[model samples]
Target: MNSALQKSSSIFRTAAMQVRHTSVTRYIGTPPQVRISTAEKCAHIAVIVGTILAGPAWVLVHLQDYKK
Candidate 1:
Protein backbone atom coordinates (compact mmCIF):
# COMPACT_ATOMS: atom_id res chain seq x y z
CA MET A 1 0.00 0.00 0.00
CA ASN A 2 2.93 2.36 0.74
CA SER A 3 4.47 1.63 -2.68
CA ALA A 4 1.17 2.37 -4.46
CA LEU A 5 0.90 5.80 -2.74
CA GLN A 6 4.32 6.91 -4.16
CA LYS A 7 4.29 8.64 -7.56
CA SER A 8 5.98 6.90 -10.52
CA SER A 9 7.40 10.24 -11.72
CA SER A 10 9.01 10.96 -8.29
CA ILE A 11 10.96 7.64 -8.42
CA PHE A 12 12.22 8.26 -12.00
CA ARG A 13 12.81 11.90 -12.97
CA THR A 14 13.81 11.06 -16.58
CA ALA A 15 10.88 10.50 -18.94
CA ALA A 16 13.07 8.26 -21.18
CA MET A 17 14.02 5.90 -18.28
CA GLN A 18 12.45 2.45 -18.69
CA VAL A 19 10.59 1.32 -15.58
CA ARG A 20 9.93 -2.41 -14.92
CA HIS A 21 7.22 -3.79 -17.23
CA THR A 22 4.19 -5.23 -15.42
CA SER A 23 2.92 -8.27 -17.40
CA VAL A 24 -0.93 -8.29 -17.70
CA THR A 25 -1.26 -12.08 -18.01
CA ARG A 26 -4.22 -13.52 -16.06
CA TYR A 27 -3.32 -15.64 -12.98
CA ILE A 28 -6.32 -17.80 -13.96
CA GLY A 29 -6.53 -18.99 -17.59
CA THR A 30 -9.06 -17.49 -20.08
CA PRO A 31 -12.64 -18.82 -19.78
CA PRO A 32 -13.44 -20.35 -23.24
CA GLN A 33 -10.14 -22.25 -23.33
CA VAL A 34 -10.91 -23.79 -19.89
CA ARG A 35 -11.88 -27.46 -20.33
CA ILE A 36 -14.83 -29.19 -18.61
CA SER A 37 -14.04 -32.81 -17.67
CA THR A 38 -16.34 -35.67 -18.86
CA ALA A 39 -18.22 -36.06 -15.55
CA GLU A 40 -18.73 -32.29 -15.22
CA LYS A 41 -20.02 -32.05 -18.79
CA CYS A 42 -22.47 -34.88 -18.05
CA ALA A 43 -23.69 -33.14 -14.92
CA HIS A 44 -24.34 -29.90 -16.79
CA ILE A 45 -26.20 -31.80 -19.49
CA ALA A 46 -28.30 -33.57 -16.85
CA VAL A 47 -29.39 -30.27 -15.25
CA ILE A 48 -30.50 -28.85 -18.62
CA VAL A 49 -32.38 -32.05 -19.49
CA GLY A 50 -33.99 -32.21 -16.05
CA THR A 51 -35.19 -28.60 -16.36
CA ILE A 52 -36.74 -29.40 -19.74
CA LEU A 53 -38.58 -32.45 -18.35
CA ALA A 54 -39.54 -30.99 -14.98
CA GLY A 55 -41.00 -27.76 -16.45
CA PRO A 56 -43.65 -29.59 -18.48
CA ALA A 57 -44.48 -32.04 -15.66
CA TRP A 58 -44.89 -29.17 -13.21
CA VAL A 59 -47.22 -27.32 -15.60
CA LEU A 60 -49.32 -30.47 -16.08
CA VAL A 61 -49.62 -31.10 -12.32
CA HIS A 62 -50.60 -27.47 -11.56
CA LEU A 63 -53.05 -27.31 -14.51
CA GLN A 64 -54.90 -30.36 -13.08
CA ASP A 65 -55.25 -28.80 -9.58
CA TYR A 66 -55.84 -25.14 -10.58
CA LYS A 67 -58.39 -25.74 -13.41
CA LYS A 68 -60.63 -22.78 -14.32
Candidate 2:
Protein backbone atom coordinates (compact mmCIF):
# COMPACT_ATOMS: atom_id res chain seq x y z
CA MET A 1 0.00 0.00 0.00
CA ASN A 2 2.79 2.40 0.91
CA SER A 3 4.63 1.59 -2.29
CA ALA A 4 1.49 2.20 -4.28
CA LEU A 5 1.04 5.57 -2.58
CA GLN A 6 4.65 6.50 -3.33
CA LYS A 7 4.22 5.57 -6.96
CA SER A 8 1.05 7.61 -7.18
CA SER A 9 2.73 10.63 -5.62
CA SER A 10 5.67 10.36 -8.02
CA ILE A 11 3.32 10.30 -10.96
CA PHE A 12 1.52 13.32 -9.59
CA ARG A 13 4.84 15.12 -9.09
CA THR A 14 5.84 14.50 -12.67
CA ALA A 15 2.47 15.73 -13.85
CA ALA A 16 2.71 18.84 -11.71
CA MET A 17 6.22 19.55 -12.93
CA GLN A 18 5.11 19.29 -16.53
CA VAL A 19 2.48 21.99 -16.04
CA ARG A 20 3.16 25.57 -17.13
CA HIS A 21 3.85 27.88 -14.21
CA THR A 22 2.77 31.40 -15.29
CA SER A 23 3.53 32.37 -18.88
CA VAL A 24 1.91 31.03 -22.01
CA THR A 25 5.12 31.30 -24.00
CA ARG A 26 7.51 30.00 -21.33
CA TYR A 27 8.02 26.35 -22.16
CA ILE A 28 8.90 23.59 -19.72
CA GLY A 29 11.25 20.76 -20.69
CA THR A 30 8.95 17.79 -20.37
CA PRO A 31 6.14 17.55 -22.85
CA PRO A 32 3.19 17.80 -20.48
CA GLN A 33 1.01 14.79 -20.05
CA VAL A 34 -1.73 17.35 -19.65
CA ARG A 35 -2.42 20.58 -21.52
CA ILE A 36 0.14 23.14 -20.32
CA SER A 37 -0.89 26.15 -22.34
CA THR A 38 -2.93 28.89 -20.65
CA ALA A 39 -5.48 28.96 -23.42
CA GLU A 40 -5.88 25.23 -23.32
CA LYS A 41 -6.31 25.27 -19.57
CA CYS A 42 -8.87 28.05 -19.76
CA ALA A 43 -10.75 26.23 -22.47
CA HIS A 44 -10.73 23.05 -20.41
CA ILE A 45 -12.02 24.95 -17.40
CA ALA A 46 -14.75 26.57 -19.45
CA VAL A 47 -15.86 23.25 -20.83
CA ILE A 48 -15.94 21.69 -17.36
CA VAL A 49 -17.81 24.61 -15.81
CA GLY A 50 -20.25 24.72 -18.69
CA THR A 51 -20.86 21.01 -18.35
CA ILE A 52 -21.47 21.32 -14.63
CA LEU A 53 -23.74 24.29 -15.02
CA ALA A 54 -25.64 22.73 -17.89
CA GLY A 55 -27.26 20.06 -15.72
CA PRO A 56 -28.72 22.48 -13.19
CA ALA A 57 -29.44 25.17 -15.73
CA TRP A 58 -31.32 22.77 -17.95
CA VAL A 59 -33.33 21.47 -15.01
CA LEU A 60 -34.20 24.97 -13.91
CA VAL A 61 -35.29 25.95 -17.41
CA HIS A 62 -37.55 22.93 -17.64
CA LEU A 63 -38.48 22.75 -13.97
CA GLN A 64 -42.07 23.96 -14.45
CA ASP A 65 -42.99 20.83 -16.35
CA TYR A 66 -42.31 18.61 -13.28
CA LYS A 67 -44.61 20.72 -11.10
CA LYS A 68 -47.70 18.88 -12.41
Candidate 3:
Protein backbone atom coordinates (compact mmCIF):
# COMPACT_ATOMS: atom_id res chain seq x y z
CA MET A 1 0.00 0.00 0.00
CA ASN A 2 2.80 2.43 0.90
CA SER A 3 4.67 1.68 -2.34
CA ALA A 4 1.52 2.26 -4.34
CA LEU A 5 1.01 5.62 -2.69
CA GLN A 6 4.65 6.55 -3.41
CA LYS A 7 4.31 5.55 -7.06
CA SER A 8 1.15 7.65 -7.51
CA SER A 9 2.78 10.64 -5.84
CA SER A 10 5.84 10.25 -8.07
CA ILE A 11 3.70 10.18 -11.19
CA PHE A 12 1.80 13.26 -10.09
CA ARG A 13 5.05 15.11 -9.37
CA THR A 14 6.48 14.12 -12.77
CA ALA A 15 3.35 15.36 -14.58
CA ALA A 16 3.46 18.65 -12.70
CA MET A 17 7.16 19.08 -13.56
CA GLN A 18 6.46 18.36 -17.24
CA VAL A 19 3.65 20.90 -17.31
CA ARG A 20 5.91 23.55 -15.78
CA HIS A 21 8.72 22.86 -18.24
CA THR A 22 6.35 22.88 -21.23
CA SER A 23 4.84 26.21 -20.16
CA VAL A 24 8.30 27.70 -19.68
CA THR A 25 9.43 26.45 -23.08
CA ARG A 26 6.30 27.86 -24.72
CA TYR A 27 6.95 31.28 -23.19
CA ILE A 28 10.58 31.15 -24.33
CA GLY A 29 9.64 30.19 -27.90
CA THR A 30 9.41 32.81 -30.65
CA PRO A 31 6.23 34.84 -30.41
CA PRO A 32 3.79 35.05 -33.29
CA GLN A 33 4.70 37.73 -35.81
CA VAL A 34 2.55 40.83 -36.23
CA ARG A 35 1.91 42.49 -39.59
CA ILE A 36 0.30 45.93 -39.80
CA SER A 37 -1.41 45.56 -43.18
CA THR A 38 -3.96 47.91 -44.73
CA ALA A 39 -6.78 45.59 -43.74
CA GLU A 40 -5.63 45.60 -40.16
CA LYS A 41 -5.41 49.37 -40.22
CA CYS A 42 -8.92 49.60 -41.63
CA ALA A 43 -10.19 47.23 -38.95
CA HIS A 44 -8.56 49.32 -36.25
CA ILE A 45 -10.16 52.44 -37.68
CA ALA A 46 -13.55 50.73 -37.69
CA VAL A 47 -13.12 49.73 -34.08
CA ILE A 48 -12.18 53.27 -33.12
CA VAL A 49 -15.12 54.67 -35.04
CA GLY A 50 -17.47 52.21 -33.40
CA THR A 51 -16.12 53.07 -29.97
CA ILE A 52 -16.42 56.77 -30.60
CA LEU A 53 -19.89 56.42 -32.13
CA ALA A 54 -21.16 54.44 -29.15
CA GLY A 55 -20.71 57.38 -26.77
CA PRO A 56 -22.55 59.92 -28.93
CA ALA A 57 -25.23 57.40 -29.83
CA TRP A 58 -25.79 56.61 -26.16
CA VAL A 59 -25.92 60.30 -25.31
CA LEU A 60 -28.40 60.96 -28.11
CA VAL A 61 -30.54 58.02 -27.13
CA HIS A 62 -30.69 59.14 -23.46
CA LEU A 63 -30.71 62.90 -24.09
CA GLN A 64 -34.41 63.23 -23.30
CA ASP A 65 -33.99 61.73 -19.82
CA TYR A 66 -31.46 64.38 -18.84
CA LYS A 67 -33.88 67.28 -19.56
CA LYS A 68 -36.06 66.36 -16.57
Candidate 4:
Protein backbone atom coordinates (compact mmCIF):
# COMPACT_ATOMS: atom_id res chain seq x y z
CA MET A 1 0.00 0.00 0.00
CA ASN A 2 2.83 2.39 0.80
CA SER A 3 4.52 1.60 -2.47
CA ALA A 4 1.28 2.09 -4.35
CA LEU A 5 0.73 5.48 -2.75
CA GLN A 6 4.28 6.51 -3.53
CA LYS A 7 3.87 5.49 -7.14
CA SER A 8 0.57 7.37 -7.43
CA SER A 9 2.06 10.54 -6.00
CA SER A 10 5.07 10.24 -8.28
CA ILE A 11 2.82 9.90 -11.32
CA PHE A 12 0.73 12.88 -10.19
CA ARG A 13 3.83 14.99 -9.66
CA THR A 14 5.11 14.18 -13.16
CA ALA A 15 1.74 15.00 -14.71
CA ALA A 16 1.52 18.28 -12.82
CA MET A 17 5.03 19.24 -13.92
CA GLN A 18 4.20 18.49 -17.54
CA VAL A 19 1.06 20.61 -17.34
CA ARG A 20 3.00 23.50 -15.82
CA HIS A 21 5.69 23.29 -18.48
CA THR A 22 3.15 23.17 -21.30
CA SER A 23 1.20 26.14 -19.96
CA VAL A 24 4.33 28.24 -19.58
CA THR A 25 5.65 27.29 -23.00
CA ARG A 26 2.32 27.92 -24.71
CA TYR A 27 1.21 31.15 -23.04
CA ILE A 28 4.00 32.71 -20.96
CA GLY A 29 6.45 32.65 -23.87
CA THR A 30 4.07 34.41 -26.28
CA PRO A 31 3.89 38.18 -26.60
CA PRO A 32 0.37 39.49 -26.77
CA GLN A 33 -0.51 41.19 -30.06
CA VAL A 34 -3.38 43.13 -28.48
CA ARG A 35 -2.72 43.70 -24.84
CA ILE A 36 -5.83 43.53 -22.70
CA SER A 37 -6.91 46.74 -21.00
CA THR A 38 -7.70 46.80 -17.27
CA ALA A 39 -11.44 46.54 -17.91
CA GLU A 40 -10.89 43.63 -20.28
CA LYS A 41 -8.71 41.96 -17.71
CA CYS A 42 -11.40 42.45 -15.07
CA ALA A 43 -13.97 40.92 -17.42
CA HIS A 44 -11.77 37.95 -18.09
CA ILE A 45 -11.28 37.50 -14.36
CA ALA A 46 -15.04 37.72 -13.80
CA VAL A 47 -15.62 35.07 -16.46
CA ILE A 48 -13.14 32.76 -14.83
CA VAL A 49 -14.71 33.37 -11.40
CA GLY A 50 -18.16 32.77 -12.77
CA THR A 51 -17.03 29.54 -14.39
CA ILE A 52 -15.65 28.31 -11.08
CA LEU A 53 -18.79 29.37 -9.26
CA ALA A 54 -21.07 27.64 -11.75
CA GLY A 55 -20.20 24.15 -10.52
CA PRO A 56 -21.15 24.95 -6.92
CA ALA A 57 -24.24 26.85 -8.07
CA TRP A 58 -25.41 23.80 -10.01
CA VAL A 59 -24.85 21.53 -7.01
CA LEU A 60 -26.77 23.89 -4.71
CA VAL A 61 -29.68 24.06 -7.12
CA HIS A 62 -29.81 20.31 -7.36
CA LEU A 63 -29.69 19.93 -3.59
CA GLN A 64 -32.56 22.38 -3.18
CA ASP A 65 -34.61 20.57 -5.75
CA TYR A 66 -33.88 17.25 -4.09
CA LYS A 67 -35.19 18.56 -0.77
CA LYS A 68 -38.49 19.68 -2.34
Instruction: State the C-alpha lDDT per candidate.
Output: 0.72, 0.85, 0.92, 0.92
Q: Which sections of candidate 2 miss by over 4 Å?
A: 1-35
Candidate 1 per-residue lDDT over residues 1-68, each given as its tens digit? 66754666555644434332333332556577868899999999999999889988898989968787
Better lDDT candidate (2, 4):
4
Better of 1 and 2 by TM-score: 2
Question: What lDDT does model 2 reach?
Answer: 0.85
Model 3, residue 9: C-alpha shift (Å): 0.2
- lDDT value, residue 38 of candidate 1: 96
lDDT of 4 by residue, 1-68 (tens): 99999999999999999999988786565687888899999999999999999999999879978788
lDDT of 2 by residue, 3-60 (tens): 9999999999887766744454576688668758889889999999999999999999
Q: Please give the lDDT score for candidate 3.
A: 0.92
C-alpha TM-score for every candidate: 0.40, 0.46, 0.41, 0.45
Backbone clash pairs for candidate 4 read none
Give the least accurate 10-residue stretch of model 3, judged by summed lDDT: 26-35
Worst 10 residues of 4 by lDDT: 23-32
Q: Model 3: per-residue lDDT, tens digit, 1-68?
A: 99999999999999999999998885646664976889989999999999989999999999999888
TM-score-sorted candidate list, best first = 2, 4, 3, 1
